[model samples]
Every structure is written in C-alpha cells, then in structure tokens.
Target: MNIAVIGLGLIGGSLIRALAARGHRVLGFDADPAVRATARDAAARMPATGRWQVTATIRDVAADADLVVLAVPLPALHNVLDALVASGFHGLITDVTSVKGQVRDAVATRLTGAANPVAGFVGGHPMAGREASGFASGDAALFTGCAWVLCLDEGVGLDDWLTVAELITELGARVVPATTEEHDRAVAAISHVPHLMASALAANAAEDLLALTLAAGSFRDGTRVAATRPELVAAMCGGNAEAVKLALAHVIQRLDGAMQALEERDPVKAVRAWAAEGHATRGAWPPDPGRPEEVPAHVETLLRLGRAGGWVTTVAPDRRTVTGFLPVSNA
Candidate 1:
C-alpha cells in the first residue's frame, strides 16, 4: 500500500512505523522538520522496506498514496481534507481525530464536490495515546493491541471499510465499527471526561503547594494524562459537547456523593468504597477481551456472553473482561 500520513506527531509517527513494518510504501508529511527527520530514521529501523519520503507539501505526500491518513488533531482534519480535495488528490481518506461526530459533519459540509465525496471518507480514532507528544516519544508498538475505531458514514462501501480495517489491523490494532454519535458518546465517558477530570483534580491539588509537593505515585499516575496536549484535549471536549456534558453530569454526581460522604466524617469508607468498586468492577469484568468492546454492538455480545458464562467486564479503569471460551469438543 502506498500510504501518506500527515501530522507526524506521536500518532502519525507511530503509524508510519507500523505501516513500514508491513513493507508498505509510506510517505510522511509534517510541519515540523525535526519530526520528519525522526520519522525517516524510524522507518529505516523497521523489518520491512518501503519508499519512505518526507515532504512539507501535502500534495507531494498525497500524490501517489493509495490511502491517506490525516493523523493530525481533530480541528485540522477538515482543513487537511479540503486541501487534499483542492489539490485534486485521488485516494481513500480517513482521519485519527478523537471526536468523530463533528469531524464527519465537517467533511460532509466542507469537502463537497464531484471529486470529493463522503463515501471516500472514513472517520477514525485510535483509542490509544501517550501522555507525551511529538515524534520523539513515538514507539513502534504504541497501537499494538489497541482499539482503532472505524466510523462508517453513508456511501462508504464495504470494500473501503475493509481496506481501512486492513490498514489499521496491519499496524497491529484491532478494528471496530462505530457510528459517529455512538463513538463520541462512549469515548466521552471513558476517555474525554477522564482527561478533563484528571486535569481538574491535578489543578485543584496544585493550590496546596506544600501538600502537592509531597504528592505520591498515586497522584502522579492519576494525573499523567493531564499533561497531554491541552489544545487537542480541548478539541475533543468541545467537538463532542453534548455527549461530554452528559458524561460530566454523571461525573459530577459521583463527585458530590464522594464529597457528601467526606463531609459526614466517613471519608475513609468513601475512599475504600471507591477503590473497592474499581477493584471489584475490574475483577468481575472479562480478562483479555478484544477491541470490539469499544463499540456498543460488541458490548452486548460481551454482556450476553458474560451473563451466560459468569463474566463481568468494565470500561471504567481500562477494558477488562473475565469469561470462559466454550470448551472445544471433538466431533
């Protein structure tokens, strides 16, 4: 596959490494020269060989690519697509934007033409990231075993979906299909709201400078993602406002309950219950469940299988499920 990846940050850089490993001809484009240099070197280290090139111009990168991935931030997705459409580029396009509902709308509205249609666009988000940014922190295995979402819009053919899924799967991710609205709502609960909460918690704690100075591993670990690119997080939160607002309502209720318990001098019990709930939830959840859990369709499958097999799975602290695969029988 001749692949063009824009952005060249952690997500884009990691994609380059993954594709290169499968011997795909990958061309990378980024605004930052240093990132391009690093990606070029990273491509060399892969087991497979491909024509790895870097260019400042999007047209040059998209010129020969059969598949184009706009791995830039959510806000940039539309702009990139617009430019590609203007450049008369011909290829199937997808993006790794966190918020899909808005992105899908943007593409549908902005990139309208006989040349550019919604059918050529597949909205995507990889539910895997690092607290760090930039190409330097990109690891070859960053997306390995992670959930890569494929949001199919109307007119996107079965063959296009399969092509996109194959590209992502070859990069070591499991593919799951999602509607734009469904993806936003679910991720708002699991990913977006958590980042907002982490930042809020860490910020509030910082007011107590002396106390925060003694912050332990727990605090640091809890707030690790609070250090992610603020602009990107903002885009995610803002893009999916309705879903995030609903998710935050649940968050607020939980926080108020916890606070009320603390005010009643039962802080220890409150804390214990919170921690235990996480433990119990994770324990009840299935173990080693695959990426389809990211989608609601497979969620019921998991629940049905769980109820039938005494498995309980959760998405809260990270995906986990506990269940028994039906025993093999000799025929």
Candidate 2:
C-alpha cells in the first residue's frame, strides 16, 4: 500500500517503520521540519526494508497515496480531513486519535458537506503508548503485543478494513472493531480518567521533598504515567468531556467506598474486599462482548491505577501472594 502518515510523532513514526518494514511505501508529513528530520533519522534507529519519504505539506504527501493514516492530535484531525476533502483527494482514511466519537462527528460535519462527502474514513485508536512523546521517543515495536481498536462505518469496505488490519498486524498488534461511542466510553474509563488520577497523585506527592525522598518503588510505580505529555492528555480529556465525566464519576464511587471502609477502621477486611471486587471487575474485563481476545496486560495496570489511586501490586509470577500492598492484578 502507498501510505501517507501525518503528524510524524510517536504513533506516526511507529507506523512509518511498521509499514515500511512490510514493504509498503510510506510518506511522512509533519508541520515541524525538525520532526520530519527526526522521522528520516529514525530509519537508522529502526531500519526499514522499503522506500520511505518525508514532506512538510500534507497535500504533497497524501496527494497520490492509497491510504492516509492521520496520527495527529485529536483537535487537528478535522482540519486536516477538511483540507484533504477540499483538495479533491479521496482515499481510505483512518486515524490514531484517542477519542473517536468527536472525531467521527467532526468528519460527519466537515467532510460530508454537499461539496464533498467522505466515503472512507475510519476512526482508530492504538491502545499503546509511552510516557514519552514525539518522534524521537517512538519505537517501531511500540504497538507490538498491544491491542489496536478500529471503529468502522458501513461505508468502509471489508478490503479497506482488512488493509488497515494487515498494517496493524504487521506492527504486531491484533485489531478489534468498536463503534465510536463504544470506543470513547471504553477509553474514558480505561485511559483518560486514569491519567487525571495519576497526575493528581503525583502533584500531591511533589509538594514534599522529604516525602518524595522516602518514596520507594510504590510512589515511583504509581506516578509513572503522570509523566505523559500533558498537552495531549488535556486535549483528549477536553475532546471527550461527557464520557470522561462519567468515568470520573465511576472512579469517585469506588474511592468513596474505599474511604468509607477506611473511616470504619476495619482496614484489613475492608481493603481486602475492595481489592477483591475491583480485581474481579477488571479480571473479567474485555467486557466488550464483541471482542473475542483476552484483555491486554496493560488493562490490568490501568485498572490497578484506577482502583488504588496509585500503583500497588504484590502477586509475583512465582505464584506467591505478598502480604503487604496488594497482589498484582493478574499481571
């Protein structure tokens, strides 16, 4: 496939490497010249077998491509799609935006105008990333062993869906279908809300140097994702407001129950019951009655972060449960 990848950041760079490795021609485009340079330099870090190209303008890069993978920030997706439509470029379009409902609505409004109707736009979110951002930090293997969600519309043909699935599969990911509403709700509960909690916990802990000094693995582990790129997170939360609000409400309910348990001073049994129930809810996850695959490993981590307000794990691979914090949630 001839593919044009916009954004050239973590997700885009990783996709470039994956597509090129599979012998597909990939053209990279980014607003920042430095990022374009970084994408070119990535070939040395993660060498690819097929030809790769980079450009500054989205039009030049996407003009003749068979597929366009928009890996830009959530807010930028609609504008780019509008430009693509205006330029009379039609292709199978997909995106790596975290929140899909808003993107879907935006495309419906902008690309489906009487002037140009978008016939092939699919929303996707690769449930894989790191605290690091930008092209420099993107790893070609970032999506490896991860789950990638693709929200398909009836307009998208099976061949187009399979093309995107094959690209993701070559990147070492399994593809799952979700509706825009389903994708937004799932990400709000699993991804966006947890990021807020991580940032809050980390901020509270940052106040005292002495406390931070005494902080061992627990504090470090708990706050690890707090280091995520703040701007991107902020945009994601703002874009998916209602769903994230619902997720936060759910989190508050769990926290309220834990607080009630603590107030009664029956910490032992109370915490145990809380952990058990929370773990069970997560353990039985996938909860997506449609996806046949098991929940990914990071799902447990996200659940742990949401339930405990910080990272806490005790169960080891040796099969023994530790006495202190909590057993690792099926890690």
Candidate 3:
C-alpha cells in the first residue's frame, strides 16, 4: 500500500519504519525541518526495508497515497485535516492520537462532502508510546504486543474499518474495536487518570531528599510516565476533558473515603475495608487477556469482543474474518 504519514514524531516515525519494513511504500512529513532531515538521514543507514521518502510539504504526502496517517498532536488535528481536505485526499485516513472522540467529530464534519459522501475515515489510536519524543526515539518494534484502537462507531464503513484493522494487525499490534465514546471513557479511566496520579505522586515526592533516596520499585514504576513531556501530557488530558472529568470524580471519591478511613478510631480496619477492592484489583495487575480465536470480522462481533476485554489479533485480508482474543470475565 502507498501510505503517507504526517508528524514524524516517535509514533509517526515508528509507523513509517514498521509499515515500510513490511514492504509498504511510505512518504512521511514533519513540521520541523531538522526532524525531516534527521529521518531522511536515518533512513539512509537502515537496510532497504521498503520504498519511502520524506516529503517537503504536507500537500505532497497525500498525492496518490492509499492511506494517510495523521500522527500529529490532538490540537493540530483540525489543521492537518483542513490541509488534506484542501489537497483533495479522498483515500482511507487514520490517526495515532490518544483521543478519539474529537478526531471522529472532526472527520465527520471536515471530510464528509457531497462529492465524497462515503469518506473512508476510521478514527484510530494506537495505545503505544514512549516518554521521549522526536524522530530519534522511533523503533519499528514499539507497537509489538500493544493494543491499537480502531473506532467502531455505527457510521464507520466496514471495509474502511477492516483496512485500518488489517494495517494495525500487520504491524503486530492487537486491534481493539470500540465506539468513540467507549474508547474515550475507557482510556480516561485507565490512561489519563493514571498519568495524573503519576504526576501527583512525583510532585509530592520532589525535593524531599529522604523520599527520593528511599524510593524503590513501587515509587519508581508508579511515577514512570510522569517522565513524559509536559506539553504532550497536557494535550492528552485536556483534549478529552469531559471524559477525564467523569473518571476523576470516581477517583476523588475513593481517595476521600481512604482519607476519612485514616482518621477513624480503628484506622487499620477502616483503611483495609476501604481498600479491599483496590487490593484485589492491584493484585490482578495485567489481567489474563484471554485465549485467541478466529471469528467472523463483523462489526457487532468485534464490538462484543472489545466490550468483553478482547482484541483482534489478525484480520483476514478479504475482510471476511479475524483472529481475535476473547478475554474472560473472571480469569
């Protein structure tokens, strides 16, 4: 497939390398001239994986490309789409953004015109990243074993969704189909809130010499993603503010209860009672993702699999079936 990718940052650059390595022609573009030069120079030393080049302009990236990946930050999505719209790119488009709800709305509004009523836009968010940014940290192996989300909203075209899913599964990541709303809510409870927790933990311990010295695996691991760039974290948390707010309410309530428990007469018993569910949840830290199975690659089945904590490992090339992992409810 001929593919064009915008924003040659870590995930974007990695997408380029991974797809090209799999023999897909790729053309990538970055706003930063230095990053563009770096990618071009780096692509030189790597063995010929597939045919790819760094385009001089965003407009050029869409020319004759089968798929165009918008890997830019959340706030920049509109501008990128506008550029693509102006350039008359009617090919299949997907994104690697953290937030999906906003992207879905934007695609529906901007890309759906009378001339192109059936816009092949499938909102995507690859649940993979690094604390580091730029094209320098990109690795084709970054997405291996990761969960790549492909929005499965009602209006999403089946063929378009399958095409994006196929590309994601080909890159060695499991495709988790979900609605834009479900995807946003799930990610807020999991990814966004966790990042906030990590930030708070790090902030509370900063400049305290003893706390820093005594920090072990628990503290270090808990605060790992706190090392991510601030602007990037802000965009992620801010872009999905409504969902994040809803998720934060539950977290705040639990924390308030825990604090109240600490002040009780029988503090130990109270605290443990307050934390029983949390303990069980933490103990199940990477829950068994269930066994893999092949199923018809229909939207209803994919959504059912996702709601059951399952993911699609492989989609049949003809879009008729998929090999997916259907997770257990209590394993």
Candidate 4:
C-alpha cells in the first residue's frame, strides 16, 4: 500500500517503520521541520524494500496515497483533517487519537465535500504508547501484542474497515471494534482516570520531598504515568471529561470506603479483602498474544443487556463463570 503518515511523532514514526518493514511504501509528514528531519533519518535506516520518504508538505504526502494515518495529537486532529480535505486526498483515513467521539465528528464534518480528502474515515486509537514523545522515541515493536481499537463511523464501508484492520493486524496488534462512545468510556476507566490518579498521587507526594526520596517500588510504579507530557494528558482527560469524571467518582467512592474501613477497630480484614479484590482483578487480565476473544453467538444480546445496566456473567469455554459489573445505564 502507498501510505502517508501525518505527524511523525512516536506513533507516526513507529507506523512508518512497521508498515515499511512490512513492504508498504510509506511517506511521512510533520508540521515541525525537525520532526520531518528526524523521520527522514530514521526512514533511511529501515531495510524494507518499499520506498520511503519524508514529504515537505501535507499535500505531497496525501497525493496518490492509498491510505493516510493521522497520528497527531488529539487537539490537532481536526485541523489536520481540514488540511487533508483541502489537499484533495480521497483515500482511506484513520487516526491514532485517544479520544474518538471528537475525531469522528470532525471527520464527518470536514471530509464531506465533493473533492474531500477521504473516501472513508475510521477513528482509531492504538492502546499502545510511551510516556515519551517524538520521532526519536519511535519503535516498530511498540505496538506488538497490543490492542488497537477501531471506531467505524456510519459512513465507513465494510471493505474500508477491513483494509484498515488488515494493516493494523499486519503490524502485530489485535484489532478490536468499538463504537466511539464505548471506546471513550472504556479508555476513561482504564487509561485517562489512571493517568489523573497517578498525576494527583505524584503531586500530593511532592509536598514532602523527604518522603518522596524514600519512595520505592510502589510509588515509582504507581506514579510512572505521571511523567507523561502534560499537554497529552490534559487533552486525553479533558476530551473525555464526562467519562473520566464518572470513573473518578467511582474511585473516590472506593477510596472513601477504604478510608472508613481504616478507621475500624480491626482494619486489617476490611483492607485486606479490598486489596485482595483488586489483586484478583488485576491478576485476571487476559494474556494478549495477537488474537482477540471469540465473539459469542449471543454477543448482541449480551451487549444490549450490558447497556441496559445489567450485571454480565461470562461462562468460559469450560464451566467456569466470570462475573463483571456493568454501568446501570448507558452514559
């Protein structure tokens, strides 16, 4: 495929390497001259047979491209879409933004004219990233064994979705289909809220320099995400503010319960049980080996029940049953 990747940051640069390594011609573009230069240097070192270059302008990158991946920051996505539309790009388009709702809306609004840049647009968020940014941090292996979420809007055709999914799967990531709203809510609970919690924990601990100095494994691991770029964190959390707020509220309620339990005459039992629950939950995270779970025959029914605020139980291939909580109602 003749692919163009906008924003030669970690995700974009990595995609260039991965796609080119898989023998796809890749043209990279970045607004920043330095980033483009960095990408040029990096592309030179790849051993793929496919042609690779760094385009001087977005039009040069988008022209004659079979697919274009927007790996820019969340806030800049819409503008990039506008530029692509203006440049007359009519290829398949997808993005690596964390938030999907805004990006979906932007694509629908901006890429609609007769000469619009996109034949189809799918909102994508690779559940893989580093705290680091830029082309220098690019690694083709970054997305290996990771979950890549794809949000196909109503306008996107099945063939377009398959093409995008095939490219992502070729890069060694499991492709998971999700609605924009579902993707936002899931990421809020799993990624956004945790990032805020890490930031908050780090900030609170900063007040006591001596205590921070003595902080070991737990503190280091817990607060690791706090070191992510503030702008990226702000965009992610702010873009999904409502979902993040709900996740945070649930966390606060849990923490309040833990605090109340700590005040009991014998707090160990209460605290231990709470901690055990989390430990068990974390331990059960399914191992990812580049394949997604099989969809059940009654998947749509299960999803409808979940959206209607019902508790869901999944019976394993064996007789074991796994129960999980669902939102009382869709947000």
Candidate 5:
C-alpha cells in the first residue's frame, strides 16, 4: 500500500514508521523544513526493508497515494484539506485530530465545492499520544494497544471506513467507530478535562517552591499531561470548546460537592465516600479483551443514534442490544 502522511510530527512521523514497517510505501510531508529533515534522518535509520521517504510538499506526498493520513493539528487540518482539494489529489483521507466534528464539517464544506472532491475523508483520533511533540519524539510503538476512534458520518463510504480500520489494526490499534459528536463529547470528558485538571494542578503548585519540592509520585502522575505542547492542547481543548465546556461544568459541580462535603458534620465520611466512588469507577473499567473481528452491530446502531442527538448505552454482556435515550429536541 502507498501511504502518505502530512504534518510529520509525533503522530505523523510515527505513522510513517509504522506503515513502512508493515511494508507500505510511506511518503511524509511537513510544513517545517526542520521537521522534514528530522523525519528523513529517522527514515534513514530504519531497516532497509521499510520504504520511507520525506516529501517536500503536500502535493508530492499526495501524488499516487493509496491513503493520505493527515497528522496535523486541528487548526491546520482544514487548510491542508483545502490544499489537497486545490491540488486535485483524490484519495482516501483520514486524520489524527483529537476533535472530530470540526474536521468533518471542514471536509464536507471543502469537498462539496471542490472541482473534484477527494475519494473520501474520514475523521479519526487515535486515543494515543504523549506529553512530547515533533518528529524527534515519533515512535512506531506509540499506538500499539490503543483505541483509535474513527468518526463516521453520512459522507463516509463503508469501504473507505473499513480500509481505514484495517490500517489502524495493522498498526496494532483497535478501531472504535463513533459519530463526530459522540467522539467529541466522550474525549472532552476523558481526555480534554483531564489535561485541564493537570495543567491547573501544575500551575497552582508552581507558585510554591516548597510545595513543588514536596511533590511526589501522585503529583507527578497527576500533572504529567501538563507538559504536553501548548499549541496541541489549545487546538484540542479549543476545537471541542462546547463539549469541553459542558464536561468542565460537570467537573466543577463534582468539585463543588466535594468542597461542600468537607464542611459537613462528618467530613471524613463524606469525603471518603466521594473519593470511593471515583476509585470504584476507575477500578471497574473493563479490560481490553483483544480487538474484535468486527465492531458489534449494536455499536454501529448506537453511533447512528448518537448522530441524531441521543445518548446510547450498551446493555450488559448479553452482547446483543443497545439502549438509546433521545434528547428532548430529537424526541
């Protein structure tokens, strides 16, 4: 397979290595010359069997490619898509943007007006990354055993979705199908909010040198994500603003409860119970039972419902049905 990856940063560079390792011809592109040089150096170090090259421009990368993976940040995605459309390179397109809705909208708007729209564009977010950035930090193993969320909408063809899924699986990641809205909301709660909390903790502690010196494993673990690239963090949390706002509101409400509980007659019991709930919730996360051959039919149905302004919950392990609660607006 001929794969082209734009942006050549951590995710893009990693994809180049991973796809090349799988015997796919990978051409990488980055706006920054330094990044391109770094990727070229990295490619040179890889085994001779892996076909990898760094391209000078997006058009060069897109030319005759079977798949084009956009590993650029959210802010740059639409512009890149516009460039691709202008260049008249039509092929399957996928992205590693953390937020999906915006990207999907951009693709739809751009391609709808293009002289020749690309073969397809699928919004994807790999549930994998690090506090690091740039091509120098690229690692083929970064996505191994991670959940790669694929956002499907009316515009996506089933075959294109499957092709992207197969590529993700080849890179050792599970392909979890989701709607753009669902993907944004879920990540806001699980990923974006956590990063915000981590940044908050780190900023608060930084004011006190004594507190910083006293910080241990818990603080270190809690604030690790605070070190992530500011531009990347801004693109993610900002791109999914509404969802992140809602998630942050819920987080604030929970914190308010904890704060109020501390003033109760029996503070220890109140705080302990609150803490226990989180502990239990974390402990109950289902273990990844290796990737399924096909995402369950019910899961796809849930994604469809999610697109129509509803919440879907998977029923207990009967593994056959999903329940959706529609929003009042939809109802």
Candidate 6:
C-alpha cells in the first residue's frame, strides 16, 4: 500500500514506522520542521525492511499516496482536510484521532454537493497510545493486539472500510467496526473519562506531600495516564466534550453511591454492597471471545458486531466475508 501519514507525533510517527516496516511505501509529513528533521535523521540511522520518507509538504505526501492517514490533533483536522482537498488529491482518507464524530462531520462538511458524501472517508481511531509524545516515542508495535475502530456509519463504502481495516489488521490490531455515535459514546465512557479521573486523582494527591511519598502500586497503576501530556489529553477529551460530560456524570453518580454508603448506619455492609458491583464488573477484565466466525461483509452486520463488543481479526481478500469474534451480549 502506498500511504502518507501527516503529523509526526507519537501516533503518526509510529504509523509511519509500522507501515514502512511492513513493506508499504509510506510518506510522512509534519508541520513542525523539528519533527520532520527528527524523522529524517531517524530514517537515516534506522534500517527497515520497507520504504518510507519524510516529505516537506502535504501536497507532496498526497501526490503518490493511495491512502492518506491524518494523524493530526482534533483541532488541526479540518485545516489538514482542507489542505488535502486543496492539493486536488482524492482517494481514501482515514484518521487516528481519538474522537470519531468530529472527523465524520469535518469530512461531511467538505463533501457537500458531492455525489457520495461518505464514500471515501472512513473514520478511524486506533485504541493504542503511550503517555509520551513525538517521533522519539515512535513504536512500530504500538498497535499490536489493540482494538482499532473503523466507523461503519451510514453511507460509508464497505470497500473503503475494508481497505482501512485490512491495513489495521496487518499492523496486528483487531479491527472493530462501529457507528460514529457508538464509537464516541463508548470511548467517552472508557478512554476519555478514565483520563479525567486519572488526572484529577493525581492532582488531588499532589496537594499532600505524605500521600505522594506513600504512593505505591495502587496509586501508580491508577494514575498512570496522568503522566500523559495535558495538551494531548485536553485535545482528545475536549473533542468529544458532550459525550464525555455524560460519561463523567454517570461516573460521578456511581462515586456518590459509594460516598453515601460510607455514612450509612451499617457502613461496612453498605460499602461492601457498593464494592460488589464494581468487583463483579472489573473481575471480568476481559470477556472470552470464543471463536472466529465469518461475517458477511456488510455495514449493518459489521456495526452489530462492534456494538456487541466484537472485532474482526481478518478480512477475506475478495471482500466476501470477515473473520471476526464477538463476546456474548447479555443485552
């Protein structure tokens, strides 16, 4: 696959290396000269089985690219899309942005008065990252075994979605199909809210020197993502603010239940009751996906699989079917 990845931050740089390592011709561009220079210097020293280079311009990156992966932050997505449109290059476009709805809307905005608004745009969010940022933190294996979402929203071409999914599966990530709304809401509950909780917990603990000094496995494990760059966390969480707000409120309600229980007459029993719900939930750290089945290559079926917490491990080359696994849905 001939590919171009814009933004040489942690995700973009990692994507570039991953694709290039897999023998795909990848062209990378970063708005910052320092980042481009860093990648260029690394390209000189690091030997890979495949080919990739740092381009000076977005237009140049798009020129030979069959698929363009925008790895920019949410705020810069529209501008980068504008540049892609201005470059007069029209092909498959996907993104690694954490939020999905905004990307879907941004592409839709540009596609007004078109024959097919959602034909080329396949909203994507790889459920993978590290606390660190920049090219120095690039990891070719970052996405290994992660859930990479490819939004199967209405009007998205199955072929386009499959192309993106195939690439993701090649990177050793499970491709999960989902609607834009579903992806946003689910991620808000899982990814966005956790970041907020981690940050808040770390910040509150910082006020007490004794707490910081006494912090151990529990605090370190819980607050790990608090080590992430605030700007990056803000961009992701803010991009899906409405969904995050709802998820955050839900979490608050749960905490309130536990807090109120602490004041009950039988505090021990009340607390135990509150903790049981969480204990049961977390005890199922991961549900068993029994086996892979061939699902018909259709949007509705794919989305259903995703909504049920399933993922496609492989896609047939002919696009007739996808090999996927789905957890048993109680609902």
Q: What tens digits encode model 3's per-residue C-alpha lDDT throughout 1-331?
A: 8999999998999999998899998999988899999999988887887546998888899887989999999878888888888888878889988999888888888888785443588888888877777788999999998988899898888898998888889889988999999999999999999999999999999889999999999999999999887887798889899999999999999999999999999999999899899877767766676777888988899899888788998887677999989755442
lDDT of 2 at 260: 81
lDDT of each: 0.72, 0.72, 0.87, 0.76, 0.78, 0.88
- Per-residue alpha-carbon lDDT of candidate 6 for residues 152-264, written as tens digits (9 for 90 to 100): 88778889999999899989999999989899999999889999999999998978999999999989988999887788789888889999999999999999998999999
Candidate 3 C-alpha error for residue 180, in Å: 0.5
Which residue pairs does candidate 3 place in steric collision?
A: none
Worst 10 residues of 6 by lDDT: 110-119
Total clashing pairs for each candidate: 9, 2, 0, 1, 0, 0
lDDT of 4 by residue, 228-327 (tens): 9899899999988988899899999999989988987889987987788677667655422232233332334334433443322223333222222333
lDDT of 5 by residue, 107-218 (tens): 7787754467678888898877776777888888888867777777766776676667667867877566687888999999999999999999999987899999999999
Query: What global local distance difference test value does model 4 have?
Result: 0.76
Give the local distance difference test score of model 5: 0.78
Error of 4 at 256 (Å): 1.1
lDDT string for model 2 (233-287, tens) is 8998999999999999999999998888887677888888887977887676543
Off by over 4 Å in 6: 46-49, 111-119, 328-331
- Global CA lDDT computed for model 2: 0.72
Stretches of candidate 4 off by over 4 Å are 48-51, 113-117, 288-331
Candidate 2 total steric clashes = 2
Question: lDDT score, residue 33, model 4?
Answer: 93
**How far off is model 4, as Cα RMSD?**
6.9
TM-score to native of every candidate shown: 0.79, 0.79, 0.93, 0.85, 0.86, 0.93
Candidate 1 per-residue lDDT, tens place, 1-331, comes to 8888999888988787677767888889987777777777766665555446788788889888888888888766766767777767767888888988887778767665675643478888887877677887777699886777777555665457656766776676755565677778889998999899889879989779897989999888878889877987898899899999999999898878778767766789877776675677556654445333332223444334323322222222222322223212221
Among residues 3 or more apart in sequence or in different chains, the pairs in candidate 1 whose N, CA or C atoms overlap within 3 Å are 284-312, 285-312, 285-313, 285-321, 285-322, 286-321, 286-322, 287-321, 287-322
